[model samples]
Target chain A: MAITGVLRPGHAQIRVLDLEEGVKFYRDVLGLVDMGRDSQGRHYFKAWDERDHHSVLIRQADKTGIDLFGFKVDSEATLEKFEKDLQAYGVTTKRIPAGEMMNTGERVQFTLNNGHAIELYADKKDVGNGLGYHNPKPWGPDAERGIAPTRLDHALLAGGDLDQALDIFVNVLGFYLVEEVVAPDGMKIAVWLSCSNKTHDIAFLRHAEDGKLHHVSFWLETWEKVLRAADIMSMNDVPVDIGPTRHGITRGATIYAWDRSGNRFETFSGGYPAYPDHAVITWPVEHLPEGLDYAQRKLHETFLTVFS
Target chain B: METQKGNTTSVMTEEAYEYVKITIAETGESFDCSTNESVLEGMRRLGKRGIPVGCRSGGCSVCKCQVVKGEYHQHRPMSTEYISKQELEENCVLTCCIKPKDNLEVKVIGKMHKNVCEK
Candidate 1:
């Protein structure tokens, strides 16, 4: 078995305009399982298959966007090592005590060059996915509710310095650039990266702004489920941004929609497998039409400009 | 639901408010949306929270609401994707810029539209 020091996207702390409404949208519409609220009034939710207590944390704020994106490390020692590595790299690192995030453990928080908060943690209470591990069924009743994604898949963020961010993620975090779109001037327009075998565990776009969230993506089981997610969004009156189509970048079926607070979230599924040894795929910035949406082949204006 | 005439109420102030009664179909809760503003603005100002407001510039249409019964004038909506022409012709309005011409009744489609969001 290979080492996955940084396991996966554990949680995303997102801001919503209203807590109750956010709860309604995330729980009833997005079909995530609510893990109860903390003293800070931050709400916790997890996809049906997630064993960790929560993968999505939302707090009510005057504005909409992300506060931090967290990845779970393999162990506490790995988390500590990453923190020290970040400090050695001249990045400021802070520690959030365990229990600060309810069932979550101590987190090493650091800010990226373009102003996005990132964190690594080693522990969180596993509240099993409703099904018992011994002779458990394939799915539960919760799986059929709302737009039930199987798990929190990845995040797409926008920031100005892709080179700096890439250095940190590759040198410090063990992520490999699987695919990238470059400008004629040799600047990276966007990057798709992976830590495990999946195409992209997280991605970033070159933007004029620092610390903007493009979208927090959830993994559905299949393309059919992606379509069902779009169906659920429409049934609930959620405003969609794009898709119910395929993305040319990851070859993933997707639907980008805004939660009630205007923050973008994606229901995504089906991307090709990626390996660390694979050659990095590149695209010209001019070909963003097919690089973005395959069938439409139209680069959406809002896709680039709208970020929370 | 049939449209019914509602008694007009107003509060005289530096920012005079036209009182339009709004009933949330999902919750059966009623509030005044008569700030002479977009239904989204009036909803916010009236302290009727939970209605999502995005790009208050009338872009993004995250605040689309269905008019159960009311009359109001609005400029061209930022996009017809959220509230389609058919829906608009059927009395749907964008909450970001809905100005209630009189006391009226309406339901919020911001969280609950009929079809599965696909046209």
Candidate 2:
């Protein structure tokens, strides 16, 4: 009950080059439950265990990157309150009418200092994870499918002026800093923030450009599943950026790969649960190689530069 | 017209297409690229890490390179943010989007450049 405003990561809208190719990869390879296409031709999907109608949306475009990332709020009142609060803090918010994104309620949209569009919404039609209310089953057929993840976990975004964006997420959105990576100059180059017990609900990396996407991560159950994800990626010839290794930062077991459109996604598991009372864990830039890849003890150049 | 001449599979049966030699200016590696095939596709088929795999389209800009000495045709538009007017004029293009028009030499300048050159 303590976790109120900005409950969890609700959805991320991505832009892909080919709609059908994206559908094949996300639905068949990644194992997300396809929620069908909208009137605007944007396809929607959700993790098998997620109760919400959809958490990932993709549309065909000339470019490849994320369009927006949204979070769910506790109630309609909380949504309105946050809008006013954000406005008071000199941030503008726009109300996108309900049904604009099918099953999703009206969204209060705003852009961060780093040029990423963020949304806050209070309502989404819960379709029940294929398990009825009373005496529901543990899992269904979808859970056993290709690289099936439990839920959309978090996203690491790349952009400049990350400190300003971090302040907005912490001070205004009711999130607390869970971990940070500091540069030689003592400025935080990367930050992980949390709204719930999860290690990070969303993270940011300082970069030269604005609105760059590092990766959108999905939560798997165990280390075995992370390895299975790698197998599936190899089977499908999906290009992997890094991992099937451990991150020294969150201690999460992960594998980073690209979708057909070049947008990066992660299949991850095993990060220490973070709470509001816990002190922020800091990683020095000097220790970043160990901080990024604990097993290899090497920092990858692609991890720093190649972002969509 | 699919003839297997050793390891190379020639699919240029119906059309009179020729393979152009492409040299990696950074690593001194060279590969045979078909005139109809994109430079990235050719290098990728080499089964080596000459250039990083990006979108295989023009969008990601991860496969960007400078045409140090080459004639290529850009089939798709590169992002203006990455390839500015001056950069484009300097023959900077995404390798995934350009097909070799003749024998060429290119410098790896993409974000993953170090992965190839340093190695």
How much lDDT does each candidate structure score?
Answer: 0.79, 0.85
* TM-score for each model: 0.76, 0.87
Native contacts kept, each candidate:
0.00, 0.10
Q: Write the per-residue lDDT of candidate 1 for residues A19-55, one digit (tens) a residue.
A: 7767888888889998999888999999999999999
State the C-alpha RMSD over the true interface residues for candidate 1, after superposing those residues.
10.7
Candidate 2 local accuracy as lDDT? 0.85
Q: Write the per-residue lDDT of candidate 2 for residues A1-308, one digit (tens) a residue.
A: 88899999999998887788778888888999999998999999999999999999999876678999999999999999999999999999999999999899999999998889999999999998998789999999999788999999999998998988898999999899998999888999999999999999999999998999899999999999999999987666566778899999999999988877678899999999899999999999988898889999998867887777
Worst 10 residues of 2 chain A by lDDT: A232-241
Candidate 2 DockQ vs. native: 0.17
Off by over 4 Å in 1: B1-119
Specify the poorest-scoring 10-residue window by lDDT in model 1 chain A. A232-241
Clashing residue pairs in candidate 1 are A234-B116, A234-B117, A235-B116, B18-B34
Candidate 2 local lDDT, B1-119, one digit each (tens): 01111111223433766799989888999999887667887888778677776655455677888888978887555545456667777787788768788999988888755233222
User: C-alpha displacement of A199 in model 2, angstroms?
Assistant: 0.4
DockQ of each: 0.05, 0.17
Candidate 2 wrong stretches, greater than 4 Å: B1-20, B32-59, B66-92, B97-104, B111-119
